[model samples]
Target: MASDDLFLTPLNALHLELGARMVPFAGYSMPVQYAGLMAEHQHTRTAASLFDVSHMGQLRLSGPDAAAAFESLMPVDVQGLGVNKQRYGLLLNEAGGILDDLMFVNTGEDLFVIVNGACKVNDLAHMQATIGTRCTITPMPDHALLALQGPQAVEVLKRLAPGVESLVFMTGGNFAWGEVPLFVTRSGYTGEDGFEISLHKDQAEAFARALLAEPEVKPAGLGARNSLRLEAGLCLYGNDLDQTTTPVEAAINWAMQKVRRTGGERAGGFPGADFVLAQLDGRLPTERLRVGLIAKERVPVREPAELQNMDGQKVGQVTSGLLSPTLNQPIAMGYVRPEYSIEGTELFAIVRGKPVPMTVTKMPFVPTRYYRG
Candidate 1:
């Protein structure tokens, strides 16, 4: 893609001023790093980092049938979600494959949605096509989304927006940063106590500047964001998940509540619910499963690397991998044959035709520090 074809966010100028290295991501010119990837990654873990996620899409759904109609598109308890509560959801196809992963909040009178940057267009179209007649779908293209993440995020944000401190994980409410109208969710891609703030584009620069003015908050980019989420064992839509992968195969079946399962009150109404539910109940077989791998040797195994067993026969392939900045070791997530999904099972990653020893292990390579209370 040409540089001229790239889209800019509300914080584009601010990011340039802060010495961020901008890169093309999902049709937008986004900051990939500031200071450096490693430094930014560590800063977010220890303190707070502000990320410009405005490139992602935001939408509002209203009307009497909004919740029920929206619930029919994904396997989750959207109708039962309490006011100001949020949940992670998956967009599935007829074959039980993931279309895109998203987050939705039942904010009193309306449903607020946030979808991946790369898939926002398709996601919007899909929703409109399926539920247009049942509800009001309003796209918020003029909004800016920001994520303030880490252990000290609450401390930093609450000082500016009161009542934010009272929020627990997966809950959110309307708040303000001085005169700016803000809708904040106590959730984030990183496995940390954080908040994702949605505000109008006009005030994004001023608000982002205000947040950066805080001593606890620093500007971070997409590079650091990816590393942080990976450490938390979160899935990146295009990388670890895609149209060909199902929630059950991705090991994220937990997001599908019992209400959408085989025998619940509102069971099997969403797309691909039948196969997904069967897989959930052990009636359907999965060819492979997503698992976390820790490299025994120091070599870093990256995506597209083939996985092999003791006999050197290929069993699966690596989807995402890197040298974990926190652990100071190499960690990766990948899909493997069902029989090879056991924790502690030894495997090898083909890096440059050489076998690098690795072991399957539980995820969240670095333990998550979510604030539930």
Candidate 2:
């Protein structure tokens, strides 16, 4: 690799051997494709696919007051989250702006946390500077994160780990991959039955190879990963969410535990709690909320395109838009006026200065395939 080349994950060599097209994402040279987006996507839906997601940051939080201290910046009821279960949430700024969306999974009574790769450095710095007194945050950069997702993910997983087939979503446990310590979580971004395996960096290659040896598992890339998440109606942090977006407008109110709501016990202590609470108290109408839009034609809409009402009044702009391989249509997610957010509501998208007919539709462009078993 050249001096200016991006960093490579432990699975980089494995991905290269599989003919993956590598690209720079979040400062890491990751695969964007192996076969093709459509093929890779369908393979995952019908079978299983493995993804190298080590670029994401993993951290452990501990101390006497770990859970309480971490909740100071997040809007979720962190303390009440059960051990071995994970919850998604946002890290907000003082003004209610989102710093980043993350996941917190309780590994033990004193430890929990997982953050985004793009913001991990700053997230750690900010958390330490602000809440260091009550908790100690340790970044686990030595580990690699890999995801195996699809309808057959469980079956493929059970080939190595018994009892994995019964693991519920958003849950995790300590396991072993041929005697090597592994932390396997029954969660993924693809909205399918899967697991995100966190393991020693040195073990990534061997583990991935073992999984690929199965007839059901194929190597997937970033292109299919994006499409799969879109099909599942999940948000991409930087594209769908940013410092300017709030959890309310993003339609992620479920992430806020009831105890963290306004006037409830333990309320108004997180960052921008006043603004968030006021928004939750009917003071905010959720005027512009996240919704899916189906374009009239095959013309894929990209970000920053204007969304218009029936009367041609501009309402909002698309945050993340793309042609969904699974749905075989152009699908997009954007904030639209609440009045126009109802399913089947007709709307228009300003595409290249022209109004393209659109309709407000239910999200997860393709129905999610989460394993409820």
Candidate 3:
């Protein structure tokens, strides 16, 4: 890809002015960190942190047959989703491979969808080609996305948009901030209580600037975001999950509603149902899937590290691995055989040609702080 093809988010100028270290990720020029990774990470855990997620794709799907049309593409029971409620789902190829993971919201008049920044273009293009006839798909190119994450996120958002206080997790509401229409969702990727707001791109910089005016709201970047999600036991596409992985093995089997799996009235007519259903019949082969690793040392274990058995036999590979700022120790996520996936199961990681001791530990190395109320 050419440098000219790099995408820029609405907050690009603000990020640069703040001395953020810019890096190319997911086809966009984004901040990897500002004011150091450890400081930003700690700030978010203790208070609120502002994140520019404008690069993510936001779309509106509508038509009289929208729900029915969308059901043909995803496994989620869209017809049952209450208005303004958000549901997590995946877009699968004909072979049942995960084309992309996304969230869909029932907005009374239309369905609002958000997809990963890196996969948005392909996701949008594919949707147009497949479901265009049944539903109208429109990309919200003029919008900007922002995440306010941490324990104090609710309080921060409440002061600005009082309506946010009533919005529960996975729910969204429209509000006004000085006449600027804002869509706030009490949802986030940080494993903490927070909200993701979508608004016009022209208003992003001013909105971000106003949010940062708060002492608790500091600008955070991709580096801290990655460590935060990994610590939350969340999967990062292209690493923890991909086309080769299935929902069952990815530890997301819970996502597949039983009604859809049992071939009820809405049975297994979707893609890859034959093999996927067959696996659901009996004990699945214990292949290496998503698992946590507790590194024995302070040094962080990067991705692609070779994981081996007690006898030095190769078992699996590390996908998303990093040192935890909150844990004060190294933590990693990878795939390992069912036998080796047991918590406390000891294994070795070859880092720089040295066998490093590691053990399987329950993921979300730290407890999640999502609001239960």
Best by lDDT: 1
Question: How does model 3 score by TM-score?
Answer: 0.96
Clashes of 2: 0
User: What is the C-alpha lDDT profile of model 3 across 1-373, one tens digit per residue?
Assistant: 2346888898999999999999998899999999998898899999999999988899999999888777777766787789999888877766566778888889899999999988999999888888898899999999999999998888888887777888888999798788889998888888888999999999999989989987789999999999999999888888887788766667777777777788568767666766666666654463556789998877778798989998999998888888888888888888887778889988898999988888899978989888857
Error of 2 at 60 (Å): 0.2
User: Scored by Cα lDDT, where does model 2 land?
Assistant: 0.85
**How many clashes in each candidate?**
0, 0, 1
TM-score quality measure for candidate 1 = 0.98
| lDDT values for all models | 0.93, 0.85, 0.85
Ranking by lDDT: 1, 2, 3
lDDT tens digits, residue span 1-373, model 1:
2359998898898999999999999999999998999999999999999999998999999999999999999998899999999999899999889999999999999999999999999999999999999999999999999999999999999998988999999999999988888999999987888999999999999999889999999999998888888888999999999999999999997898877886756999889878888887889999999999999889989998999999999999999999899988888999999999999999999999999999999998999888899
Residue pairs that clash (backbone atoms under 3 angstroms), model 3: 263-267
Off by over 4 Å in 1: 1-3
What are the runs in model 3 whose C-alpha is more than 4 Å off?
Answer: 1-3, 283-286
Best by TM-score: 1
lDDT of 2 at 93: 93
